[model samples]
Target: MQAFTNADMSDKGATKPGFAISAWPDTRDILARLYDLANKEPVLAIKREQMERYLGYFEHKCIKSKSMTSAAMELIPGGVQHNLAFNHPFPLAIKKAEAAYLWDVDGNRYIDFLQAGGPTVLGSNYAPVQEKVIELIRECGPVTGLFHEYELKLAEIINHYMPSVEVFRMLATGTEAVMGAIRAARTFTGKAKVIKMGGAYHGWSDQMVFGMRIPGIGALESHGIPAGCYEHTQECFPNDIEALAAMLKNNEAQGGTAAVILEPLGPESGTRPVIYEFNACVRKLCDEYGTLLIFDEVVTGFRMGLGGAQGFFGVKPDLTVFGKCVAGGYPAAGGVGGRRDVMQCFAAGLQGLKKRAMVGGTLSANPLSCAAGYFSIKAMAETDAPIKAGKAGDRLTAGLKEIIKRRDLPFVAFNHGSICHLETAAAMLMDINNPKIFTEVSERKHVMEEMGAAFTAEGIISLAGSRLYTSMADSDAVIDDALDRFDRVLGSVEKKK
Candidate 1:
């Protein structure tokens, strides 16, 4: 892979019209800082008394949430339906969301840095998009189990913004889209093996559940999944072009590789960011190896800008996986798009063809989701939501760095436009080969969980206590307020004995 240069950074860092990231993150520097923090002894953590007070907020102010979750635990596994909802102490039941805020069942408003897992770039419950969805629902209901005009509109808009996406096929979720993309790649290339960067999450599909979250620990979390499911799935460390090439070379003797799928911004939305030129290098390798490249843009589809990371990086993959902002935070928000020849493998209806990749969803491309997505993209373009959101992220990251410095903390902070990361414990950066990986991860994770609880107590909602996705609704005032809250939380941290 090519080394990053000042010119390279200048070229891609301009936040061109339609791109979300105002500046690409310094991947090498960030990684070095994170690794240093990970190797340090006596992890910086919230003081025990401070953590008790933060937990007290959950016990006292969140009484209703606790009661509701306690009752729900009897029926719902882990007391939450979604992974994102599973908080440290207990999940808070959100009653309302608007702009950059969320109101819990107890009527406590929080700065919604989670942004519905990076979908609502225009902010939570954006009025214009919500009104369009309401109008559509009132006219035709949410789903009709049949053709919808908005589906075509949504696909057309996607193609317009992403010309490389010659055709689009809507699905119900990012998982389904990944399944479809992989199947299409196999059919198109007549190969069965697939390669993904270790630690990159494509979704929860059986074949994709391998090497999740932390790299080099393949199938550690694949409890219910059988070994046969991921026999053909291979993983290589992120940004290691040589390893990827070697894997592709090895696959040639084992029926060849069908596709190389990855989250364009790196695993977990840049939690493990890639160098600016990494995607281009991957694209070249895919062409050389006769493999399809699939960009999983579930979080970056519209949030990273209308053109997404692909457009911003000037790299075109053979297939693009869409989710999250695809439906503008609406349900059933996912799809796959790519070269015309490859996408034809998913041609709907029974048409006798040499090959076909089967995929189905009752609610896929329903009227409600389509309308929501169509209007949301339009709104994002009209208001430059991605750019505005990116600016907000820049402000938040800058403020976080200042706080980390002022507090003399070892935490690292950085951002790729709207997606920001604050690495307090560096739990995710732990080396896989460490003798006490699991034990260290657990200890560091506890610290992270405590940090998340502290943020919540300070009236801020972050993803996993590390990631903060800023939206267009996050104005300078909102960011400043969040910074104040962040300052409080950071200031409360102390080295764990």
Candidate 2:
């Protein structure tokens, strides 16, 4: 099959494809130039000053949020439940969220760019989805510890959109889904070692967390994890086909590779992007090595398109791990889907299956989550939320690019559908092979934190101060307002320089 590219989709330049197959060259060029500009001393100083101003503003405007965060720290470690919750000054204690806006405890309002960490592609507390969820709760309740029709419906919708998924099984979180996908690959191939792209996050399972964040640092974050847990996990550079082939060849000599897994959009949701034909290249390599290719579409699944990245890229994988938008912005959103033979690993009491991965979650395929997922997919299809949100992302990207150019700032802005990334500290894309990896990350920590604070101060919420996920609710007007805020922040930083 021909490798998918921006030209494959009708809306080529308007919105980048989920897999970024065609846009890789331009993306790489821009990233290289931005990285060079960001590393300059003057640029770093200006970013530092901007961060201080925004963080100070946050401190002044969010007194109530500050108090709540302090109280939360007593009960919750780091004063936040999730990594995304802790912002620059202090995590905002949100009182309510609707559509594309959030209200903090201080009654301050901000445009919602985090999109609930990429789950709420339809927007946070989207009314139609909430209406369905509420109605389901009132009728049959949340769970029955038994079967529910919604499970079947949800599976059907997923299969409809993602044809590679001949069978499906739900899990509670993306991490569980990754663990299950890896287990299935290993079981089906009867192989040991698994190869994942460097800097790709495939959830926090002990085995899958081998190369967290920075690549080449084997199990550096494996604090309590036994060394044996990741003995078979190997890493390869993103978009480097020869490196993958070498790893697979070495693994074959070692014990054979079970699976070649990756986030289709490259590591950290395209922070480290791959070339246009990277997915197709990897697919060929996996086939040659008799290794399963698993696409961790937790962030790109439903949001990318109805067909997800696999469909967008026109390259099917042996297994697919899904999360976020898959659950329809509800809690407990994760699942594994793929060929029936391989997916049978998760089945119980099936003697015909030569191997079993033994995967199950008590809350897996629960009624409420499935219901939300089913209706969510239905809503997405009817409204074309993915395409609409992608357009919104396109507008946001264009606006940010314009802002950067106008302010003469060294930054990069781009999007894969509604998943927009604004990269300032391009230096953070650390060279995994470098011995000074820890120092590299530590030196830029303050600047990164400050950028995030500046966004928050300007009434914008983002993922880690770098990435922003737009939603279907982000209409032209909403995006324009967001652009104005972005312009303010960009201008502030540029003036400091």
Model number with the top TM-score: 1
Best by lDDT: 1
Worst 10 residues of 2 by lDDT: 6-15
For residues 109-157, what per-residue lDDT tens digits would candidate 2 score against the true structure?
A: 9999998888887778878989999999999898888989999999999
Colliding residue pairs in candidate 2: none
lDDT of 2 at 402: 94
RMSD of each: 2.3, 3.6
Candidate 2 ranges with C-alpha deviation above 4 Å:
1-25, 34-53, 350-354, 433-436, 494-497
**Candidate 1: stretches off by over 4 Å:** 1-15
TM-scores across all candidates?
A: 0.97, 0.92
Q: What is the lDDT of candidate 1?
A: 0.90
